[model samples]
Target chain A: MLDLNNIGQRYGKKQVLSDLTHRFESGVSVITGPSGVGKTTLLRLCASAERPSQGEVRWCGEVLSRTPRAFRAGLGYAPQRIDFPEDITGMDFLLHMAALKKIGLREAKSQGRALLDRLGLGRDADGRIRTYSGGMRRRLGLAQAFLGAPDILILDEPTAELDPQTAGHVNDLIFEKDAIVLMTTHLAESLSGRSFATLNIPMAQAD
Target chain B: MTLFFESLATHTRIQLSRHLRSPAIWILALAAPIAARFMLPEQGGDYSIMSINSAYLALDPATIGLQLGVIMAVILTPLAYIFLRAGPTRRQPWQADDLTPARRTAQMLGHWIADTVSLWVLMLVLGLAGVVISLFRLPLSDVRPIVTLLCLCLIAAPALAVIAGLRTIFSTRRGLRGAGGDVLFFFVWLALLLLSSAFFATRSAPPILDVFGFAAPLAGTTTERIESLVIFGPASSGDVLSLDAWSGVMSGDYLFSRLFWLVSVGVLVALFAQIYAPHKFKALRPEIVTTGPPSFSKEPVPLASANGSLISLFLSEIQLVLRPRIMIPVLLIVAAAGVVLPFRGMVGPALALLLTFPFSQQAARWRGMEMSKLSALTPLGSSAVFVRLVAMVVLSTALCLPSLVNITASGATDQMLDIVAIGLGLPLLLTALGYLTRSAVTGRLIALILWYGYLNI
Candidate 1:
């Protein structure tokens, strides 16, 4: 389980996420909120991409606020804008990430190929990533999060650029995977029958 | 044809606007030349002009023109490419809307024309300014207008072609992303430098009579025999020499040499364009993919050597530096310039500082990346990571130690030590500032501005 206790995040004087307490068990959890409601912040906090201004986050039994690397090892996060080294080939990219993540090169290559085949990008594996289409690049981002087969997967706007078919496939894949998945989606239909819970955040009121 | 011309005109206008908007172009095209001309003493009064003019009279126009042209070309060529090729958005192509073959061709031609024109105008103004200045100090009344024009064209055309070719080459390959093009660019540039040096050395009179015989070309008709002799291995025994022979070589034939170089430039551009044009003109797709076998496994790779987070961080820093991008070329150029320039008697500290400047500039991005939240996910703790960054800075200084040693050997220990201190101090300060600021672009900009200010002050 993942737990956040008395968690607060502030940008200057304004509170973004204020003393929010939540617990999530092993399953799919959809973080749904109006714009600026701190859903992305909550996800980032869970991913350990950002630290709480106050309080603490814990994963399983271990404290996550301090030891991010150890916490993130079991978690995979795909940011809203997943900026990558643009020059590398798709295969080389997988290999690079694998190396960074300390995966065996040979095993990573084999798995990379399987993943690409599954995602319908096996033929384009050797091609430079600068040549991949928008939908294809989004799938590529998803593939990276799937790497290491983390227990917890966090995706921010995963279906934004994808076509409906590709989006459905991704949703299906996330549901099929055993990992506890937390994803943010604008389209309510995308989350149907996924064993997921929703946390809706209201938009900030105008002065 | 009318539609094509209109399209070309539209393309030209767009290209010009884009160039004007770019900070890099403004910096290179306007700021650098103005700064150079300003920094250089008023032409007639400067000691450098006197010394340079006295060195070679026949080759004076070529020499001065080449010097100004080459330096401008070297600096501006890259700027031109950056302006011409860089799109508004990082992900978008330069000609995003115009995908048709004819439109694309027109757009490319339009960009080339604009860049060439810009380079030509800048060179012309600077050359005329130089000529006016030089004539005040020395008699250049006999300096042919054709020769001057040829010299300027020689420098401008090649520079434009080479830069255009490079942009084409780099646009095609994914491996040439970021500053990778700069690395390949420097190698090509160095080759050009070598060729220029070889040409200049071969064309000049013997080193022994270099002082007096240098004026032979400038003296005109009387020294025809001497000029021919000089051309054919410096008046060796059994050599028939005449004014016609020497003038033929120096005046009309000399332009041919410049033309030959221009043609070589054309050939290089054509060859590269042929190879790279088709590839470059295509629409680029985002290449990153999300799938693969695990990027990391549950099991870690066993290390041969006991590796600490510091060592890993250091290795990463080195990787960031040596990656075949713009930084590598900048480092190489700095190193090459330091070695080749005749900075004989300068204080070692100053020389060391000069050499370290490029490395420090290169390290700014590294420093920014070091402070990133990405490090929070690395095995290394923040303190250990900071230490590794510090060590990398030290290592960069150490890379320049050979030159420092040469400086020290030449009796400037005090200067060497000063350089070492400044070199080490600047990066550390910049790193701290970066951490405090928490914005990479801001940090880099501040660091660069401060560095330049410090240098000038």
Candidate 2:
């Protein structure tokens, strides 16, 4: 279980999130809000990629920042811009992610192959990442997230910049996974059939 | 600790790491003392040390150390200048966010100040040690000059660092940005830098030297020697300047000078705080930016299309070089140079170097056009690299067309040949070095070193 205890973030004077507190068990959660309500900030905070200015984020009853190695071990994050190192192959990047997540090379190879096949990017695995289309790059972002079977997956606009077919493929992957998933996207109504909770952050009231 | 202080510390540490990572700074910092050790022992280039406490005091370690401080300060300018470009203290600096502009600016300024001071102190310690330790042949008593020199350096370096740091930070403030402000900022910056280095520049009685109190620790000495000294080599054995003469805290004048600089530093700190905070700057306001379009459209381009060819990409690279924003100013500069000295036989290559900068700034783009999926299907192999390099040289040469015509009309074919070689080869060589080092700064620094050597030779 992961929980945020009154977390808040301000970049300069603009308060992005204020007194935001929430908890998530092992299930998919869709974060929705009007544009600029700090949906991405919330996901980033939960992922341990960003430290909230106020309050604390707890993972499995321990503080997230204090136990970073252990906390990040179970967390998978895909930011808005997946800056793929243009030089490396897709397969090599997945393997790099696998190593970063501390997975064994042999297991990483098999898991990498399985995940790529599941994401419909099996054919393009060996190709250089720079050659990948926008939709394909989005799939690779998902592919990296699933590398180590992370318990908490934080994806910021996963369905963004993707074709309908690619978007459908991403939705299937989300429903299929049993991990605690937090995603921010306006087109999430497509997943209406899935048993997922929605968190709507209102506009931050300025002082 | 509060998040504000924590953020300051965290950001400052990162900035320090970045400064330490610069190969130029590291090379110069370490080389300062070693260069001083060897260079100072044999000869005092322009002025000699008349008295050094005693005839046995073989070297005036204080002068060499002070000189080392100046050199180190000069070399530290690159890192200081780096802090001027952008704000620090961000996790994903992909795009500017809805944070208060002032907070980040303040943190960034703090980082620059901390980074500059840390680097200066480190260089001081290392350089001083290098000089003192390398002179192991001399007895501790003979090496007493090192102590006085180190103290002097410590005082001078702080003021120099503060001047450099504040100059960089203040240059970014509201009134001191843009083209006109750039010239003004640079002029003021250079003036302050010179004033801060007054220890070496001015050696006159009061009014002139006394006005620049900050440089006192470096040049605030009153040597009342018995002999009529030309400030030269090998004076009488009895001509020892007393310890009190060289002490950093001797006169009230030095104290007032040091106090003035310290107060000035505090005022700069307050000024930085005032300048970088949010609410005051419109650019740092919070706004929701749509991250591109909601939907994607795919338009496949055939490889045989005009826009898909390598030649088109090369032409596009040339167009990018001639874009009005970058090209107009450069053209004006070249035009002014021509007007100033229309008959100069060597203007062609100099003009070519000026024109090529815009293309070089568009780095990595020329190598492989940042193409869409359908067009970028083929790998941009070695051929594309050659095309990009040649395209830059050709375009640069085209910019130098008038100068080349001038040279041709003058019938100085030998000078024209030199122009061709430099114009065609220099950009290619520098860009290749940039590719090798994975840094444009490396390419720029190497070019600078090459030019310095060329000029000196």
Candidate 3:
């Protein structure tokens, strides 16, 4: 379980998120809102990528700040913006990320190849990431997030640049994964039938 | 420990692969050797170990090794720092590496080791070149080329390692992440070079201060202190003092100093890793804590006014060039120069160095902004670039006015032309290179090498 207890975030003089409290259980939770309502910030907090300004983010029963490395071990995150190193190939980038995740090289190679094939990036895997299209880079990010089979996944707009068929494939993977999955997306209407909690940022912040 | 080694290996492989593929690195690898080969004297030229004579000491392998050691020490620190600055360290957070479960210390040390390995690889290339140059310049029967190569490695390797460690510590540590740190390092290098010079002039300085490990080894070969040493220039008319440089390098003091620096650098890097392991392991900085109560509003931030004349544009460009972070250091340097400018021998060269800083940095920053792409779409078009270039040169010149005034008041007016030439020429050259390569890195790397050369002069 991931818990946000009265968390707030301020950038300079502006408050982006204020007094936002929520708890995520062991299942899929979809976050949706208009742009710039702190949905990505919420996800970043949950992923232990950034600390909340005023309150605590707890993973399981332990505070995320106290043991970020341990929290991160179980957490996989894909940020909205894709700013990969332009000099590296997509496959090498994945392998580098795998090394950070402490995955063995041989296992990472097999799993990374499979992930690339599944995400339709297998043909461009050897090409430099600078050559990758927006959708391809997004898929590469998704593939990295799915690597190591982490216990928690926080993805921001995972299906934004993906095609409809690829987006459907991604939804299926998200739903099938046996982990605490949190994602921010605008496809709430299409995903209406799914067994997941919808946490709207405006509503949550208002409360 | 397993994870530690894994991260180290991963970082080393990634950094090496990235650097190895660069055309600049390849060009430099080829260029440095070829350049050095031409600088050496032709066969049957008089050479000595301690003082450079007619042959510029080319045949003496140990002297060449010592010179190589000192030069590498000067060059590698900034090179490693540039590599780290340009590489993945700047963009790791955006790449999702920030969320890694791996220990921060491990990651930091891994980066340090990776940078060190890159420096060593570069050193090996240059060392091999030195070996080839030495063998080519001297008859095999006249000198033991193998011993010379080993001596070069022995002196230069530890120096490069020390530089790599210092670069890692300075570039990675939080508190030391700005122009102040750069200035501090420049002074440190300058001071060390001065110490080596002093040691060359008077062989009485302690061995431990011999950062290059060059002084003590060469001290025994000649008891007569060298009043002046010239390299790669017209040979001096002094009597040539020839001694076996290999035996001197084998002496106990030189070996101890080399070991001392190597061990000290390793310990210092380890201590830095243990103490300053990034923001993850540390508490949030005070700057992040907003003192005032947080205000909530959906109001959009105000944008800069677009209605501006060419003068206004130039002013704004100057403002960008002298942003507070840059201004503070420039002002500080000006303040220091005010006191030091009266000294006759120091004023001209010191002013030249001071004048060159802003132009080089601005050129590097201008390249980094990639503003050329954005400027093409503006109505002003090329005028905007002209304004920026003029602003950089004029503002950089204005900043040096205090020292320039001092030079004129001291009746050293002739030196003003030299300062102005360097001040104006370097930026134009660097900016041209930036435009040519479309990279912020190449011009800065060339500027760094030129900066070292100026220091030698």
Judging by DockQ against the true structure, name the best candidate. 1
Question: What are the chain B TM-scores of all models?
Answer: 0.49, 0.61, 0.74
Local accuracy of candidate 1 as per-residue lDDT tens digits, B1-457: 8877887787667665665565645444455445445423433332332122132222344544544444455445544554444422122344454345545545545555555555555556666665654454346675554555455455455556556545544644555634455556645654654454343335453222211112223233333222221210112232222222134225643445445644554454345434333334333643334456323222221211112234444444454435445656655555444443322333323433443333333333323332244334433434543654566566557545555655666774555544554557655654564454332322333344344434443
Q: Measured against the native two-chain assembly using Cα atoms, what DockQ does each of the candidate structures obtain, in the order listed? A: 0.08, 0.03, 0.02
TM-score of each: 0.50, 0.51, 0.57
State the weakest 10-residue window (summed lDDT) of model 3 chain B.
B296-305
Candidate 3 lDDT over residue span B1-457, tens digit each: 7877787677656655666666656666676677555445453345322344332443577766666654565445555555555543433442344567766556556666666666677667777777777776667775655676667777677766766676667655655544444555556666776776677666767677878665556565665555555544445554445655687777777788888988888777767766663533222322222234222222221211223346655554554455435655755575367444642345435544554444444444433332332223223434655666787667656655666667777786776665575557665766676555544454555555566665565
Best by TM-score: 3
Q: Tell the DockQ for candidate 2.
A: 0.03
Clash pairs (backbone) in predicted model 2: A11-B99, A11-B100, A12-B100, A13-B100, B102-B276, B102-B277, B102-B278
Off by over 4 Å in 2: A1-207, B1-58, B79-109, B132-140, B145-152, B167-189, B193-202, B205-259, B277-313, B325-340, B343-360, B364-378, B381-389, B408-457
On lDDT, the stronger of 1 and 3 is 3
lDDT, each prediction: 0.53, 0.56, 0.63
Kindly give the number of clashing pairs for every candidate.
Answer: 19, 7, 0
Sliding window of 10 residues with minimal summed lDDT for model 1 chain B: B227-236
Distance from true position, residue B200, model 2, in Å? 7.2
Give one digit per residue, the lDDT tens place, for model 3 in A78-115.
87875564544678767655544555556667777877
**What is candidate 1's lDDT per residue for A1-207, written digit by digit as tens?**
888888888878778887677787777888887778788888888888778898888888678966666766566676666554444467766654444444455566666676666566777776676677666677777766666667888888888787676677677667766777888988778666556787665564111
The first chain of model 2 has a TM-score of 0.95
